[model samples]
Target: MKPELLAALNAERAARRACVVVTRLADGSQRLVREDELVREPMARDTLAAPLAEALRTGRSAAIEHEGEKLFLNVHAPPVKLVATGAVHISQAMQPMARELGLDMVVIDPRGAFATPERFPSVTLLAEWPDEALARMPLDRYTAFVALTHDPKIDDPALHAALRSACFYVGALGSRKTHAKRRERLAASGFAEADIDRIRAPIGLNIGAVSPAEIALSILGEIVAALRAERVAAKAALVP
Candidate 1:
């Protein structure tokens, strides 16, 4: 309700941070906990301190008692990180697909010709070799790596990098024979057979695609399937 507190809240929101507001209750208890980190308490300030402290510590919004009034607080969290590797023709098609799926996509390629905005207008383009480029790119739980380059020199290093990171999906574009060779190469490079299996090589579903665009569609479809499968597995793990 105070102008200074309101300004502070606005500033935090502008910085993209979650905040919780706390309000006190009349019975020296906390009353309302709102999603936007705003809490209202009718209790005294001192009575509200403990609940507010707990909410802040747990990064949650809670109601607390302040002089017997209830107050509420809001909490903010960072957005998810999403990045895509390999900026080939398939990538041009895949970028829009990813955007449609609400992913923050980025394109990485060593060839300037392939990594231009003209080719990938909706994605962040990084024209560096995957080994060097992925070194700087942030890969996390929500990140997905797709290797469409089809060249072992490019795809192998990128695949290796993706496997080493916490990325949720890692795939390589190739046919069955090509994927066999890829697995051999990775094994030769000291990766375990199990690690090599992490790649969804022959990358897409067996959808009988002949064109680049159709292939991209199949690949993205597989990615979505993999994501859904992971979600389902996670839920199953929590069911018990």
Candidate 2:
């Protein structure tokens, strides 16, 4: 890697932005493709465009033959993170599963009674309001935000932040009726219909989950689905 290219790639990684280093094996030529530059960059607009986009989206490196020459694509995607609004029972159950899935988990709740260290010993527990805690964390495109607390005061602010940012998944725990009310509140607070639609209310896949553990499983399943949905679709498109 060239010094300047290495510096630029390091900068992107520090910013937690998705980037790819493409190397042409035949002649040892190399170039960097950044997510923000994918659309406008000339070099990325040819046959390499699709693979570069896929590498950024799926965070998978690949060696492929392009124009009779071998090219290697090294993907540098930010690690996926799970940020929950409340340290409730469901959040407790989610801790283990999130870790097992390799997701960096964070629980934020202001209630002293629930946000105890004993309750979340293995997780990054922030015993503070979601807005304040989230402000310190980088809520980027690789993040999955969940508002598990039913309280609007707690969940709404986090939802607003997630919607305003580029979180990959934004979910909330509530019934349809409860979500309806929440939608009304968000709309009244100046959120567009499309922005509100991004939130997966009545969160988790519909598997008739009853217990906290079961609900946590369902939510994690849904999060995984959201994370891979685009890649899955892209694969299906190539099946023909």
Candidate 3:
């Protein structure tokens, strides 16, 4: 890799941006493709869009033989961030599990009593309001948002921010009736129906969970499902 290419790649990684490096296998030539630039550069984008996007989405490299020209795509994506709002009992169960999955976990709550370092020992606890903290956290496509507070004052604002951003997953803990009411509130607040639909309310997979631990397990399972499901579906779509 050239010094300039490495520098460009490092810059993208620092900015938490997604990119692909295309290599001509025959000659070992290389060029970088930033995700944002794909749309503006039509010829290259049109030829490489499908594989480039797949590489970006899955963070996996791919090789293709197109028009007798063999090419390789090397994908680079930032680490995943899991933001759990509300330092409730479920977080105690979920935090470690999230860490075990290698996700950068941040527990957010304005209630100092709950968001204490003791409550989340060895975890990154942010004792700040959801909106302000999330603004600084800088939610992106690699982030997942979970609202466990069940309090509109806390969870709603977080959802608003996550939904507006490119966060890959958004889940909220609530019953069907509670989510219906929440939906009304969101609609009243100018959120379109589609935006409201983005929330996976009644969060966690349907596993008949009772204890906080069980609920946490279910939620993590659902989050994993959400993360990997799109890649599988997209790959299937490309098949004949």
Candidate 4:
């Protein structure tokens, strides 16, 4: 490989992006492709084209070649964001749990006393209401939104926003009665029952949690369960 190409490949690796290198074999009819640790030798360029295109389309790594040359492609995807829409005590424990799970966490709250860097040292603390704060934060398929405020003024707006977006998880901390009230309010706010149903309310597993830390643990556990279920569903859908 040329120095410039090697440097670019190193840069992409350093950035933790997926990359694929395609090389043409000395025999003009064949090609060699490498992605991560997997390698395919003597593959015709035409034969590899469809899979390569599909991989690139899915933001994955692939390789293709023609003649006696090589090329590398790196797939770079932005890090997923985990937005916790409350700076309450549970959030204090939750943020670190999310970080431990390798998530990029952002804590949002309107109260300065609650949302502080001192409390959430590694989290991106936003001292703004959910509606205002989330307007600046990007919500996508990879994002998880959790409402820990248990306050309509805070949790409602964020929940509403998350429901409208493609956020992977949307959970609100509350009891069964509180969740019923929330459903009513959401229905009144023009959200359909199906949409309101997407929220994991009474938010967390049925672990009978009574303390802040315990509640946080339950919520994170439920989140992991939901994510795993989604992956399973997706995988099942992809099966022949």
Candidate 5:
């Protein structure tokens, strides 16, 4: 890698943007394809883009046979981010679990008492309003946003942003009745029915999770399941 390429790669990493390093197995030549540029950048003949896009979407590096040459698509997706729009007990339990799964976690809360380093300890705490905090986060396809606060003032705004963006997963903590009210509120706020449905309410799998820790596990499980399902769907699109 050249110094300039190294710098470019580092900058992309810092920004949490996706890119792919394509290496030709024949001569060992390599090139970088940023997600933003992939649409416009031309590739060598036989190097179809569907596979590369799929790899980046799934964050999986793989070797593909392109016109008899083995070209390795080394995907460099941004770190998966978990932005919890609350500093509640569930967020605390989720913090350690997210870290264990290699997710970059952030806890957001406008309440000073809750959003503190001492209380949450060892995680990034954003003690600002969800609208302000989410505006700063680069919510993308690799990002996951969850509304654990259950307070519309905070969770609603954060959920709106997640729905508007390409964040792969958006979930909220609430019962069916609570989510119905939430849907009404979102509809009144100008979100279409389809858009509002993107939020997985009563979040996590229905595994009878009662305690905060178990609820956290269920939420994480749901998020992972969604991610895996998305990966499968993306790959399935390439099949003839």
Candidate 6:
């Protein structure tokens, strides 16, 4: 890679932005493709849109034939992050699972008693208001946000942030009736019905989860499903 290209790639990596390095297999010529550039550059979109989208979404590098030219797409995507609003038992149970799944876990809660380092020794705990914590660390497309506090003051603000951003998965832990009430509140706050619908209320896979650990497993399972399903959607969109 040229010095300029390497610098650009490093900048993207530092900013946690998704990008791809397209290298021509024949001549060793290479060019950098920022995630936004794919949409703005018509020529890049026409030639490499589908594959580039797949590579970026899946965070996988691949070699492909495009219009008789063999090219390599090296995808650079930030690791997926899970940001939950509560540092409760369920969040504690999710720590190891999140680690094994290679997701960076962050818990934000204003209640210091629940957000103690003693409870979440291995996880990142932010004992600040959800809105304040999220302001410092913005949610992005690769992020999964969950409102586990069951407190509107804490969870609702986080939900607003997540729904406003491009979080891949947004869920809230509650009953159907609880979620219905929450939905009404969000609508009253001016969120669109489509935006409110993005939240998976009664969160987690329907696996009859009874324990905190079980619930954590179900939630992570659902998050993984959403993550991969999005890649599948990206691929499906390219089908002729």
Choose 1 or 2, whichever is better by TM-score. Answer: 2
Summarize candidate 2's per-residue lDDT along 1-240 as a digit string, tens digits. Answer: 799999999999888788899999988899988887878757556778887887776678999888888999999987689999999999999998999898989999999999999999878999999889888985888999999989999999999999999999999999999999999999999999999999997899999999999999999999999999977788899997
- When summed lDDT is taken over every stretch of 10 residues in candidate 2, the lowest stretch is 36-45
Strongest candidate by TM-score: 5
For candidate 4, lDDT tens digit of each residue in 24-116? 434323222334323344443455555655553465543444344554444444355678888889988877778888778888899898887
Task: Report the CA-based lDDT of candidate 1 relative to the real structure.
Answer: 0.69
- Whole-model lDDT values for every prediction: 0.69, 0.91, 0.88, 0.74, 0.87, 0.92
Tell me, what's the RMSD of every candidate?
8.0, 3.1, 3.0, 7.3, 3.1, 3.3
Q: 117, model 4: CA deviation in Å?
A: 1.6
User: What 10-residue stretch in candidate 6 is worst by lDDT?
Assistant: 38-47
The parts of candidate 1 lying over 4 Å away from their true place are: 1-82, 230-240
Model 1 weakest 10-residue run by lDDT: 29-38
| Candidate 5: 10-residue stretch with minimal lDDT | 38-47
For model 6, state the Cα shift of residue 133 in Å: 1.5
**CA shift at 225, candidate 1, in angstroms?**
2.0
List candidate 6 segments past 4 Å from native: 1-7, 41-46, 49-54, 57-60, 230-240
lDDT of 1 by residue, 16-35 (tens): 35446544344333233333
Candidate 5: lDDT over CA atoms? 0.87
Best by lDDT: 6
Worst ten in a row by lDDT for model 4: 28-37
Instruction: Point out where model 4 deviates above 4 Å.
Output: 1-77, 230-240
